[model samples]
Target: MRPLTPGDVRIAACREGDLVALDRHLPSPSHPRRYTRQLAGLGTLLVAWDGGQPVGHCEVRWDGCAAAEVRGVVGDCPEVNGLFVWPESLRRHGIGTALITTAEDLVRDRSGPRIGLGVKDGNTRAAALYVRLGYRPAVPRYLDRWSYVDQDGRMHDNADPCAFLVKELG
Candidate 1:
């Protein structure tokens, strides 16, 4: 039940554990290996842990140009590559907001003015959370089946259309 900073002892020592937690939460193509690469490249990751167990996590990536696309929305922006809270801890309180606040802080320091992310269209709860945190729908409608291939040669068609969401950092 505490905020875990990047350099803090708990975070430093639990990178792998955090990765496992992330793997469990996000879907394929958004798996741990991909997440690790993205996080390393993006330069910012925040996690909330309870007694050394990662309970929530969020990450943002600099998509090279001022304009970036996330979940199908394109614009001059940084992307919220991932945000997940463990299902068991969903009702515990404050963890999701805390993780998001940390991400905003990181983006602010980088002088980023806007951030974006994609959520499955049917996932109203997650969308609501993002909206509550200031994200607004940037896309007119959800985009269809984005394809992703995993290391195992399994192809995944993200059947659930996704809606793009954006938040102004400034």
Candidate 2:
């Protein structure tokens, strides 16, 4: 796939119908229903469409896994979680940045001084992107990883060694 230009991307609030794309991005086919439910539990879910196709997504949770993980570290900050870019080929084209930026806009609308997110420890590319976008390592060196149940109510572990980061909304 050719690299996408910023002008060709549209980032917007996620609709319930986005469950299709969300499911496709999940590790297995059985994960979307539960994922959709979780996204609904969030304060906001932002999706990036590239030339009208769903390419990436991010979400802001006011009181979910993200908040629970950084409760004291970021002190009540809304968290940007579940950021994903699909197909692996659609990456490195600013779609992730657009999704995160949209998530930050949601945080700003809520009048937050800062927004928080977690990056898996070994994921240097993602960590670099967060740093370049103004996020810094939060007080806690690590936080509990994310896990969720599938449609069948079976729990799935997505555990990773992660670093919590916060960005001042200036």
| Candidate 2 whole-model C-alpha lDDT, 0 to 1 | 0.73
Cα TM-score per model: 0.68, 0.80
Q: What is the lDDT for 75 in model 2?
A: 67
Task: Write down the TM-score for model 1.
Answer: 0.68
- Which candidate's TM-score is highest? 2
lDDT of each: 0.61, 0.73
Q: Highest lDDT, which number?
A: 2
RMSD of each: 5.2, 3.2
127 in model 2: Cα distance from truth in Å?
Answer: 0.7
Would you give me the overall lDDT of model 1? 0.61
lDDT (0-100) at residue 133 of candidate 1? Answer: 89
lDDT of 1 by residue, 1-170 (tens): 45443333222222555666655553334555445655577445666665555666666666622222343345546666556667553543666777667767767887577777778767888888889889997874554455778789898775556777778887
